[model samples]
Target: MEPLALLWDGILAATDPAIFACTILGAVIGLLIGALPGLGPTAGVAIMLPVAAGFGGVAAIACLGGVYYGSMFGGAITSILLGIPGDAPSVMTVIDGYPMAQKGEAGRALGTSVFASFVGGFLGIAGLVALSVPVSRYALAFGPTEMTAMMCFALSLLSVLGGRNAFKGFTALALGLWLGMVGLDPISGLPRYTGGSMNLFDGLDFSIIAVGLFGLTAIFTSLEVNVDKPVAKYTFASLLPRVSDAVQTRWQLLQGSVVGFFVGVLPGVGASAATMISYALAKRLSPTPEKYGTGIVEGVAAPEAANNSASYGSMIPLFTLGIPGSATTAVMMGGLIMVGLQPGPLLFTENPEFVWSVFGSFAIGNLALVFLTLLLTPLLAAALFVPTAYLYPIVIAVIVYGVFAIDASTFNVTLTILAGGAGIILARLDYPAVPLILGLVLGPLLERNIRRTLIQSQGDLLVFVERPIALGLFIATVFVLLIPLFLKLTGRKKIAADEAEV
Candidate 1:
């Protein structure tokens, strides 16, 4: 069956009042979390991850997905109402959104954000519905060789494109790869680096690792430079915009939505990058490029649409390929595993019901997000009033509680703290943790697939290249590796040519 048909079937199953209510609750919770200055969607979902254990798989995931979209909507509130961005993705919104607010057009700015968010989200879902089917269907033919090559291609893209310093990204990835190799070997069922500790049998709990890397990292980072927001008076009247505003940004929304969806689908090109790139594209293409940072609705619409669409884009790989395109989805893989489910091509063939139900949740949550953001925009602005003194402590406490609550072990809590310290150190060194996390998630799969392929070929080293899909993916991996060198050489040549001309 087609992806849309499967999604439609899930929507039918998800229509139960219980699931719908969970979706609403999730959206509300997400909004509150997102409204807070630093607690973006990842933290919102991570802090609430323990509840996934109780809510059951479908309902809990429904809620998490709701929070994902709701937080995107909520992030704009602070960026427009206060000069401070709610999170990284909202940073671009502040450039144009705050200026609009300063000019007494706060409601319009907020309205544009909400409008673009809806459009972008719709386009992204449409992209998911359209693209995921073919990819999943095609992947059903994948053997161990193709799977290994694909994962290698994915890691290369993530390490090379996910951060500014590719070497640092690879270093973090190497750390994760080594860590992944600690447990009993997937092939031999024998321990390699257990250090004789039984706890090493399962290796690291990724959820604990995720919470530490993102949740604890956020909390620890907040301690150093928490800022207080000044009180501001604003009316909700302008949250409803005239039709003219929508009409003006219609093409911009379309452009941003397309850019956001495709940019978002690629692993490691996250929401922040999508928004910034979309904003730049809008500015460069605009006849009124000079008007971008001066508070134009187009500026607000472009990045808001792109980021929200990017959020939707991130979900696609997680559901279809068991590949997380961003950090939040990487964490979400743990949630899926907790439910005794794994994401991938088999999910579609074996667990069609679960797949469709999750799809339905995405639809319901996004629809609710638009309505909830519109109705509660004024109330949510109050989230900014939270003092850093109170908020930071509460967040720290919540991080500890969340880790322990889900893990139910003091050892996990200690590990979380240790992981947080590591994350902080990595951050200080300008190394990204996303690639590390991706490596951790993909490492085991890469190892398992390679072993399977090798065993099938009786240890033939030429097996990887013998397969066409694997060969193509390996070529792509080589290209990704060479990109930096190619760019460097191009830069040197450009400089030399310029010097000669001068």
Candidate 2:
């Protein structure tokens, strides 16, 4: 089927009552979750995993998709109203969003955010619709050798770009790789890390790890931080944004969306980075860069657009290459896998209906956010004031129930608790957990492909260099690895020059 026709069918299917209801339900839940100070999109998606999985099929993905983008929209509410970022990406939103609120233009600032988020998310979904097919088609040519190199390249990017400390990132990646190896050995048909237990045969479930690492870890951190709830100062004057504001920031919207989507498509880079880069670019291109932090609409618009668009952008790799660029997507990937769907190039050809239906749901969901944000911003803003003491217990209950519901196993619940403890330790030590999750997700794929390629070449390692695509990807991997060193050298040189001048 043609992409557009498939898309039309998807659009028709997404409007089904069950799918539509799930989208709205997920969006509402996500909005509340995102407005809460500590539970960001990653936790929001992670906590909802078992529920979404239970829904299954198009309904499942639709719910997850709604949560993903809805949280992006909701993140702005806390930042604008409370002067506290709801999530890492929303950190940029706080620079101007809160200031705008302080100046009594809270409605305008939120309107701009909504407008910008809508534009960014729309463009991102458009890109996803247009590019996913071609990317999948291109990726379809991947053999075992290319697949190995591709996975290696992805892991390398995660270690390098996933965190500030390469060593910590690599350490997390190694841990995840170890976790991925816990199941039976494909080659030897023997148990590896099971410790002589029957439960160890199938290894750890993805939902268990995701809920522990992101969902439970977030709750633990939130309780320790003990963030105070702040009351919103103003009722919204108007949910509708002023035309002049949108007109003035139109270029910023486009710039942010474009920059955000491309940055998001890269493995490891995330919405937070996309927003930062877009904000920097917007400021640099502005006539008055100094006005950025002073409650300017441009400031709010740029990052809002970038962050929402980046959320959509991250989906490309997840759907096409089976690589999730961020923690949220990693969990979503697990959801897809849990529902018996394998996300990869073959998905396009094999499951065109599912793919395009998801694309349609994204479009519908993005559109739904604008209405949801406008109507619910005031209510969601109030939710920010809900005490953490009340919220944490509910979140914990949900996590426990969700994990247990997966297979009705107390053992899985035990694993979740253990993983959560490990998550707390990793968090306290400042290790980036994203690489760990990605490693767990990609490790088996990498190992299987590596073995398959070696077997094909009769154990010759040189085949990696022999294939053009594999060699290119390897070279890219090397280049990515050297980026931190290059930055360090440049920083030292700049410091030396400053010292010399001093």
Candidate 3:
């Protein structure tokens, strides 16, 4: 069957009333979950996986896919209104978005976010449609060596390119790698760090750890900060962007979408990375780079668009290669597996309906997100008025409930709390949590693939360097490690020259 024909059939299946309804419902749930401080698309999808499992395959995929995009749209609400980023990706939005809000343009900022999100998400889905089949075929050639190399490249980019401090990011990566090794070794079947506890045998639950780090820690931090600061009231009159503003951001939107799509296609480089990268790129290319942090519409549009596009771009690897490109996509991949639908090349041939439904649902979900945001923004903003004292307990309960619901294990809940506490400490010390999460998520794959490659080559370590793809990744990793040093040396020289001038 031709790819176009398959896609057309998938579209028809996705538009079926049952699937459409489920998609709408999923979008609503995802938006609400994403608007909350600790819950992102990953936790939202993970919490809903069992429910999706009870449904059939098509409905399940549609629902989970909706949640993915819905969360992207909803994340901006908190960033704009409360100056609290609901997810890391939305942190970029806070740069211009909060300023717009402070200037009594909260509704306008939100409107721009919704529209840019729709455009970026739609374009990203289009890229997925055009690329998934070819990408799947390309991914079919990836062996253990290639997989390990790809994982290395992803970890390198995530750790080095993430935040201001490279050492802190590496520390987070090491901690995550250590945590990832706690379970039984996949190749040797020997326990490494179980510490004589049967509960540790399965290792830490990713969902529990994510919730603790993102959700619970966020709540705890919120308690430390005052939440009573006044925000500009938003009215319907403030809900639309100026035509001139839209025209001005046309270039930013285009550039941001492209940057976002490419970055998001890489495993573990999700919307957050894409947003930051896009923001940097936009500023570099802009004539008004200095105006970026001052609440310019272009700044808001660039990051918001990039993050949303990246959210869609994340689906590429998840659908085509069975590799999750981001944490949110990882959760969606779990949903697919739960429904007896494995992601990879065979998914296109055997489960065309599911594949198409998911892609098509993205198109629909993007539109639904716009409407849902318009309807829910006021209500969500009003939520800020509720006292922190009352809100923190509820947030804690929800995180605990959501974590336990994943595996129905109390130990998982304990892990969740501990991870949250650790995450809070890491956040305070200026450590990057994304790399830690990425390391934890990718550790099993990295370990398994390295061992498999070594075994395949009869314990030959040189095989990785001999392979072109692996060699390229190794070089890229080295480059990533060295770039910061080069930049620091150059920066120091410039500083010394300025001091000499003084």
Candidate 4:
């Protein structure tokens, strides 16, 4: 009853004219951004952070949240029409979607994609609402020791599972940790690695780093790559899917939502992975597996559903544990802090209205996207034909203006440029940047708690091992770290067995 009452309050709050307008506006902007190739939700959220943070309320959060999920819906547009994936998760969509477009079934393919996305988003948000409150309530009992262990577990999981190469992931994390340590010591008033610069006194803002690494780096990289624009081919008659198709694919959509949401709740296992897993599962279960990737509606529906659900699934850890489950959430977490709100268990207790309102706004945004995507699909598709050259200047100007507006500091602008350069270099080297962002975001929190615990225990290290919750968490961290090793050994044994059989 209490949860229901709180949820109703949230629904009411989101319906406010101002908040509703922002939510719809954000959904529209996010769709356009997502439809553009090479700029997924991660960059989209980071690029919008500075502007949204300034609004600083449920409206800001609503807008950013809209962008986060709205992009998931938008990615399907390019995949179905152009044979080019607008984002990573949408890559799977291109396999069947492009084929369908060639068959003159583009409208059906797109309608199926949008429907799947709406259903997936609905299920994911429902899961979030159901899980977040109880999980946060449970987290409230954590002490400094337990909190420290939890952070360690989250970081380890991200470093180990977040990329193709664990070593490269850890290297990125090290860079982030170094950056995290640059500010004044959390305990001591004296600066540690500020290099005697007054600008470094406040530490590097995650929002600034996010804008440079995600937003600016994307711009610089896009300018070097050339993309061919394909005209959209579809008729108004088939724009909306047949009811029979929806009925037939209903079970697969449900399967995708379930798989995506659960996978997304785990730290570092992102939506791209969820789509792959869901698509594979669908193929395995299908009687006509051979039909996959041959312009089938089920092929397009499964991955589309999974990616959208996974987006919501990733938010659980971000909201309840103050840990981001994916890169986009990490940027959103930074934006939350910039607006004077801290995400964690305490946030629920401290500001129930704000938390619920944000959740409510997600529901509203998800619904709004359905109409927006349907009505504007033709127009947005045409906009995609515009040359990339014309867009680069506008993106650059937005990035520059957003960063400079943060604190009006020329020094921060310099830092942003440096980070963008480093980001480009890192991208070329195949180094994963998500862990770096996670490390930077989680480092200070880990440090603060560890210091507080040490001070409380008079520098006794056993306090970490003595606490049962902390001990359990550390053990989980070790298990997580050994997963890659286990997989490597398993692969070697399988190869040897195959040779013996031959």
lDDT of 2 by residue, 255-316 (tens): 99999999999888899999999999999999999999999999999999999989988999
Off by over 4 Å in 1: 1-5, 229-232, 494-502
Q: Give the lDDT of residue 67 in candidate 4.
A: 88
Collision pairs in model 2 = none
Q: Give per-residue CA lDDT, model 3, range 113-153, as digits (tens).
A: 88788778877877888899898888778888998987788
Candidate 4 lDDT over 106-166, as tens digits, reads: 9999999999999999999888888999999999999889999999998888899889998
Error of 4 at 388 (Å): 2.1
Model 3 clash pairs are 38-215, 212-420
| Winner by lDDT between candidate 4 and candidate 3 | 4
TM-score each candidate. 0.95, 0.97, 0.85, 0.97
Residue pairs with backbone atoms closer than 3 Å in model 4 (clashes) = none
**Could you tell me the lDDT of residue 346 within candidate 1?**
87
Each prediction's whole-model lDDT (CA): 0.83, 0.89, 0.78, 0.89
State, as a TM-score between 0 and 1, how close model 3 is to the true structure: 0.85
Worst 10 residues of 3 by lDDT: 220-229
Candidates 2 and 3: which is better by lDDT?
A: 2
Model 2 lDDT on a 0 to 1 scale: 0.89
